[model samples]
Target: MMKHKLPPIYFLHIPKTAGSSLGQLILCSYPQGSQLNCSLSQLLQMSREEISQFKCFAGHWGTGLFSLLDKEISSITMLRDPFERTVSNCLFIKRIVVKKFASNPLALDEVEDLKLKSDISELLKCTNIREMLNLMPSMKEQQSCYLGCDIDLNEYLGVSQCSLDTLDKSKEIFIENIIAQQLSSGLLDINEIFNKAKQRLDAMEVVGIMEQFNDSAHLICNSLGISTPKNLPRENVSPENLALGNLTYRKSGTIPDDVIKQIDELTVCDREIYEYGKKLFNKQLQTEKRKFFWFKKMFKKSERF
Candidate 1:
């Protein structure tokens, strides 16, 4: 990548989107101390000078720092099958607070994050759709959460123009209210939101699909000149013990047909985005393969010359 002087890579790691697995790739490919993994809060604390030092910046960040992107920085992210991603998210939410309860001796309200953690725990445990209205957009429209700036509600709704910066700050609560409001009114323009997300994905340097991870890795490697990882490591997998030791999170389980229907209804936008993204991924994989082979041939010819 340095040989080509390509822009540094910015991974918008939407939570549970194989971020840990991708972290291993970034760590191995980049020089020591050049890779930075900071939370949204930590990122805000860093000076612009401090942020410029890293070749890679990734974590559960919203679109707040989108202005920081430029021609010198290449950006990428992965999207999973939406319904499945939602299942993984809810299960992960249920698991985390349960673990917090086991270890933290203080009351749930002692820490602010812990209180939110407990709220998430309750959200996942609730079997009814009405109780889940407060589900965070981070779980429902997660790809939008990371690529926050890409979706413009105003463009489609003809509403007041709100910047990604505004969404980054309020999208969680905003989406929750939207869901609750729609549920109450029995109408929503979810397709409008999805169209905006599709536009963003279409504009990405390259898109990755979680189910087709190996192909995605090869494409990423080819695009950035990073070594292709034959085996993408799985981190934060659900342990057999579940809710003990480390936070056990899993993407596996049989959701009831009724619950699955509810998820489908809530994540209509994600379902469309994932389907369209999968089509794009197939096209990108073949293109990356051609580039990979051509680059290899050129290198060999140069060596001989």
Candidate 2:
């Protein structure tokens, strides 16, 4: 029997984007060795020479993996609404980080818990669009400090005396500065990240919005000359993560009033991207309706004849 080798498929996992399910589907499609989860920081500790051989990579890479892979492998990712992404992140922190901390008596000091909870409540209370946008990542980062790998034993305990309040203020300013700069600049520098990955991978790229999953997957299947499944996997927003508030529509699902306000305040560049996405979704819906109408017309014509 001749051996068959499947080509590599790179999945770029963006956090809170239904990436794990997508990753599972890709893993099922490809042979075992071809899929790589790139999120592990331990991979970074490898010698530069050793790391060059890695081909396909995935996971919440924070733009770092773009510099690490070979150029030929196709890169794919899924994006979700930023507001929903923030909420999903919050739930993840509450369940994983908070629960773990509470379980470990040494990890959860009563005073620390009170302070962190207060900070989180204040963050959640933000109603102004600009302030909400500014607060989102800061709260996420604070949650990460508890859950993240970088914190040392000293930093985790009271002995270090790091003020979460002070840190939150500094983080808010830093995030605001970055957001302002990105808005004014009108382009994110993926060049450095891309160039590094390009050295090894022949192609480096991104996939957008979960709404486009089927089309995106079909394109990839066609390009690779692989069999596209009749039932291509769909991305589902978990029930627990569904939007709650005034923006809710029967078909479209709810988005809180505050979330919409935040979205409205997005910079021109970001707003342009969002509008483009909306257009694509609308176009897709129209196409589907036309197909349905065409089929109905054919059925009626056959009956009349």
Off by over 4 Å in 2: 1-8, 70-72, 105-206, 229-239, 242-256, 263-271, 274-305
Off by over 4 Å in 1: 1-6, 69-72, 104-135, 148-192, 240-253, 290-305
Model 2 residue 193 CA deviation (Å) reads 12
Model 2 residue 101 distance off true place after TM-score fit, in angstroms: 1.9
The per-model lDDT (C-alpha) reads 0.59, 0.45
Clashes (candidate 1):
0
lDDT of 1 by residue, 1-305 (tens): 34354447777676667777876676567777888776443454455566677887666554434544443666677888776677666656555545545465673443344334323334555433223324555455655434533322222231323443443433233323433344346453445455656776787777889777777777777677666766777777544324333322232333455666767777766777788888889888877778779999999999997
Evaluate model 2: give its TM-score.
0.52
**TM-score per candidate, in order?**
0.68, 0.52
User: For candidate 2, lDDT tens digit of each residue in 1-305?
Assistant: 11244455567565666777666666666555555564233444344445455545555543344345445456655555544455555445444444534666776574244335422234355333224345334332211211111111111123223343333322222222333344347553433323332332223233346555666555444434466578866455544545433332222334456554553343222233334444544554466568769999999999998
Estimate the overall C-alpha local distance difference test score of candidate 2.
Answer: 0.45
Candidate 2: residue 31 Cα off by (Å): 2.2
Clashing pairs in 1: none
